[model samples]
Target: MHIKKAIERVPGGLMLIPLLLGACVHTFAPDAGKYFGSFTNGLMTGTVPILAVWFFCMGATINLKATGVVLKKSGTLVLTKILVAWVVAMIATRLLPPGGIQTGLFTGLSVLALVTAMDMTNGGLYAALMQQYGTQEEAGAFVLTSIESGPLVSMLILGATGVAVFEPRLFVGAVLPFLIGFALGNLDAELREFFGRCVHPLIPFFGFALGCSIDLGVIAKSGFTGVFVGLAVIVITGVPLILADKVIGGGNGTAGLAASSTAGAAVANPQIIGNMIPELKPMADSATAITATACLLTAILVPILTAMWARKYEMLRNKEQSAQAAPAQNPSSLAQDGHF
Candidate 1:
């Protein structure tokens, strides 16, 4: 069957499809995990362990030997993405209620949801888009942007902006696995490839585990609000990234637009962060639903926008090249035709 191809056709399918299936199990049979009480239960309730391994394998995939252009492009996008999310979180602290909006068209929306969705660039989506519409270096920029995959960046933004507090040790724990994997991978090329192969295969497993914590009703309640947050993520992160890409990274804005997405892995962050800070626990489920919606929305939109922008940029570039060559090819004809 073409089941794998079918899923690949959906935005964020490997992650989202499994996530929805897990959500179904949670919604319909909340006791299934305990009832099974074995490896099945472990798969049902293994978000943290699965994620830890995923992070480690993800780290192994980064070679640290990327060319200067790739690093510069990625660095610009990553920093810009985080900075924009931080700024939004800071502003949101004052504008939105601490617990989030309690009523109205924006019901169930929270600062945690906004920041989580905004902070992480969907590296898989961006890499795929860039592969089609950008330079090879731009496609490779996902190597660095992958750093935004876990909850660490969200924790940093929330902590720095006073939206939440986290102990110093929590910060260390968050990145230790990834850092160790990175060191080992750099030390031995074979180990890097071995661990790297595990990265994609692990997505659905963790996605399912993460979804087991969510209720579909929450997703239904927050559907519209989630779509809004997804749009905000793209616009809020997209503009600065584009400017930074052009001015500093020496490229058109396509890469920046491509990077303005919510990572499918980001769907787990609010839940993870909420567990770290008990005060934030109440909103985690709703935040996950909202962030999941945002992940799907941006995965679809960013590519279309990036492709349009790339084609336009290419056409203009070609037109300019033709214009520049006109004088060299036929100056006499131009003068005779009253063009000079």
Candidate 2:
């Protein structure tokens, strides 16, 4: 059974396939992890730890000499994504109800859901896609996008005031493992090679763990409204990301598309932020469901879109290159054919 080969045939399949499998386990046997106990349970609940190690491995793969490029690419994507979400938040305040829509087909839609889904790029998904379709620098771009892992960015974008504030330590904590690996990797080439090898191997582990957190039922419960929010997220965030990648990040816009996905972690942000703001608490459950659906939807779609865009970009680039080389390679033939 060409299982590995089969998975590779599907875009983002290394990640998405495991994620789906895990979601199935969660949906059908929610207590399977507990029932099995020990390591099995750990794998079921090890998303954060697995991702932490993966981040370290990913950082190890980066050479410090190329840090500047990575920083620029990551920074461009991160800032553009956040800025877009902030602008949406400002508009949503006027357009959406304070308590979210409570009637009709769009009853559960809310600004919290919109912003949460819009603000954070699924770093793991972006990195996995970029590693397959982009440059090493582009793959390293997830280094900074990790900042969007929690509810802080959403809270800030949504104008959470008073006690809600950025915690410097949380930001530090987010990148510390990567930083440590980066330092060690730079200091010793052997360490870099050893740790870097672990990056790709770890993808499915965290993917499964990430999937375990999601209940596939949520998407169905949220229905078409959830699907609409998911598509809205891709379009609304994706266009700007693509343009930013071309104009600023110096790529063919594939990285931006990869970064436009909603993080699986973003599903929890609604409730976390809502707990702080009482008015939003009522909508948190709805927001969580929509965000989860968006997470799953984007996870499946962004990789496919990025893959398509990358292939098209590569074809266009090759065509241009061939066009430029034609005059140099076939000047005599051209002159004879054209009588120039």
Candidate whose TM-score is highest: 1
Global lDDT of model 2: 0.80
Query: Looking at model 2, which ten-residue stretch has the lowest summed lDDT?
Result: 159-168
Among these predictions, the greatest lDDT belongs to 1
Count of backbone clashes, every candidate in sequence: 0, 0
Model 2, residue pairs in steric clash = none
Quality of model 1 by C-alpha lDDT: 0.92
**Residues 234-270, model 2: lDDT tens digits:** 9999999999999999998999999988876676577
Looking at candidate 1, the ten consecutive residues that score lowest on lDDT are 325-334
Give the per-residue lDDT of model 1 (tens digit) for 1-340: 9998999999999999999999999999999999999999999999999999999998888888989989989999999999999999999989999998767888779989999999999888888888888889999998898788799999999999888999999999999999999999999999999999999999999999988888899899899999999999989899999999999988899999999999999999999999999999998998999999999999889888898899999999999999988756478878999988
- What are the Cα lDDT values of the candidates? 0.92, 0.80
Query: Could you tell me the lDDT of residue 118 within candidate 2?
Result: 95
